[model samples]
Target: MNLDRSIDDYLAHVRTERGYSEHTVAAYRSDLVDLAGFASGRGVEGVAGIDLALLRDWLWTATERGLARTTIARRAASARGWTAWLHRRGLIAADPGLRLKAPRAQRTLPRVVAERALADALAALADRAAGDDPVAVRDAAIAELLYASALRVSELVGLDLADVDRRRRTVRVTGKGSKERVVPYGAPAARALDRYLEVARPAILAGVAEHGKNAGGAAAPTAVFLGVRGGRLGVRSVHRQIAAMLSSIPGAGPSGPHALRHSAATHLLDGGADLRAVQEFLGHASLGTTQIYTHVSAERLKQSYRTAHPRA
Candidate 1:
């Protein structure tokens, strides 16, 4: 089969059968497409032509181009998975990627907003949301729930009306790998959600109807968050909103929804929440993934000690 066609087949298998998220599948596609182009330039026209040497050369070219270690590592992983799939299907006699290696990606601490700073920011958001402006109220709710539940932006946007249980103070979110989990929210988040649902959501949808869109008694949108055009709220919109809100706060690293997630997890860990419980709360499939917060906590403690302790 053509190399590009084979890559597409593998992508489809991962997306549908293996249940990889679109973001992951897209990354794999990018890596593989670059590999195909590199191979084609070397007169390699088929999967059979792929070999360990070519794979190594491709990685070397990436390194020479000054790609970050994380990018190079991800590309290597992508290539390994693709070649492994091909070998498993008997398309190749052996997996060339088995010996593939790349520089280890550096592990950086996730950005954690100071508790005071975050509280002040949320208070300001709440003040802005006290009015009947649909977007403002929705933004407040989004920010609250994002920090409260430590939701990924994708999971937050994917939430449907029925997924939320206000009385129970919980939401059912579909996380990565289509894993479903019910997570609880604190009263502050519950209040924000209640206000959004009671006032903002209806006003926004009503505006859509006034514009002659979603009219004629169409079925209501099920998404908990809605764009101005009355469709499900998109991931980009949420990112833009959160970025603008976090811009003024003094902090390093990304000022995105994930910062709130990282903050939530770190705060939970600092408060002495169990490591395993936090892993489940974040829907991390592995305990090791959640253990990073312990390092963040330790770093924070060291910073505090350095600043406050009296010594020679």
Candidate 2:
């Protein structure tokens, strides 16, 4: 099969059959597209030309170009998966990528906002929401639920009104790999959500209708969060909101929605929540992925001891 056609078929298989998220599929597409261009430059356009030597050379060229180890690693992974799929389909006699490898990506701890800092930030948001500004109210709810449930921003924005069960104080979220889980939130989050749903959301929608600017059209109305233009909230908008919220607080690391997620998970661990329970709560397919919070917790403890203890 031709390289581009094989890539398209693999992307479709992952997107539909394997249930990979669009973000993941896009990453795979990017890596494979680059590979195709590189191969074409070498006068090798067929899948048969993708030998182990060629794959290694591609990674080496990426390294020489000063791409981050993580980027190169992801590219290598993308190549490996595609080549294996081609081999399985009998398009290639053997999997060239079976022996392909890249430098292991460094594992950095996720950013965890200090509990007091996060609480104060939420309180400030709540105070602004008290003015009954629809956007303020919505932002408050978004921030609260993000920390309260430790949800990925994608999962948070993808929420629909029917997904929330206010009486039960729980929300049904579809997470990575399209896995579904019902996660509970605290009363604070529940209150924020109630105010947004009962007051803010309707006002925003009504205002959009009054102005004849329902940019979201039919799709906006059912979403749990909406942009100012009445469209469903997007991932970048949420990132900007959370980034602005976290900017003033003193912290190193990304100030995005996942920082709140890392904060929530670390705090849960510090408060003695069980590891497996947190694993389930975060909808992590692997407990190993969830164990990163333990490292965060330990690091926090050491910092506290270094600051408070008088020992040499």
Candidate 3:
């Protein structure tokens, strides 16, 4: 079969059977497309033409082009998975990528804001939310819930009104793999959510009603977060909002919603939350993935000791 057709089938399998998120599937598609282009350039236009040596050369070319180690590593993984799938489906005589390898990507710790700094920042947002403005109210609630639950930005924006249980202080979120998990939020988030629901959400809905732009008559949006146009809030808009908020605060790291998540996880560990529980709270499938926060906590301890020990 053609390599491009095989790649499309693999992507469909991952998206439908494996239940990988849209973002993850897009990434895999991108990597495979790049490999297919390289293979076609070298007159290797079929699945049978891919071999261990060609795979190695592809990665070597990427390295020669000065791509980041992470990108190269992901490309290698994409190739490996695709070849394995082909072998399993009897589309290939053998798995050519069984011997494939790439340089390990460096693991940099996630950026975490100090507890005091985060507190001050949220407090300032809450103060701005004191008025009856809908956008300000929504922003405050978003910041509070993000820090309180350590939720991914996708999970946050995917939230619907029916998913939140204000009385229980819990939210039902569909995480990666379309897996549903109930995560609890703190008092600040609850308070902010309540205010937004009572004051801001209805106001926005009323605007939508006035404009007669409801997508469906009775089947209108039930999303917990809404844009200025009263449609479901999108991921890019959330990123932009978080970036604008983080730009003013003094911190080092990627200025996005994930910084709040990292800070929340690190804070939980510093407060003595168990590793296993934190893993569940963050909805991580693997314990190894959750172990990174321990390193963050240890690094914090070392920094404290360096500043206050004074025994040199």
The residue ranges of model 3 lying beyond 4 angstroms of the native Cα positions read 212-220
Candidate 1 regions with alpha-carbon error over 4 angstroms? 213-220
State TM-scores per candidate: 0.97, 0.98, 0.96
For model 1, the run of ten residues with the poorest summed lDDT: 212-221
Candidate 3 local lDDT, 87-144, one digit each (tens): 9999999999999999999999999988887888888888999997898999999999
Error of 2 at 295 (Å): 0.7
Clashing residue pairs for model 2 = none
What lDDT tens digits, residue by residue, belong to model 1 across residues 1-312? 679999999999999999999989999999999999999999998999999999999999999999999999999999999999999999999999999999999999999999999999999999999877899999999999999999999999989999999999999999999899999999999999999998999999899978966554444489999888788888999999989989999979999999999999999999999999999999999999999999999999999999999971
For model 2, how does the per-residue alpha-carbon lDDT over 1-312 read when each residue is reduced to its tens digit?
789999999999999999999999999999999999999888898999999988888899999999999999999999999999999999999999999989999999999998899999999999999996999999999999999999999999999999999999999999999999999999999999999999999998888878877644654778999987788999999999999999999989999999999999999999999999999999999999999999999998899999999992
Candidate 2 has an lDDT of 0.94
| CA lDDT of every candidate | 0.94, 0.94, 0.92
Clashes of 2: 0
Q: What is the lDDT of residue 69 in candidate 2?
A: 98
Better of 1 and 3 by lDDT: 1
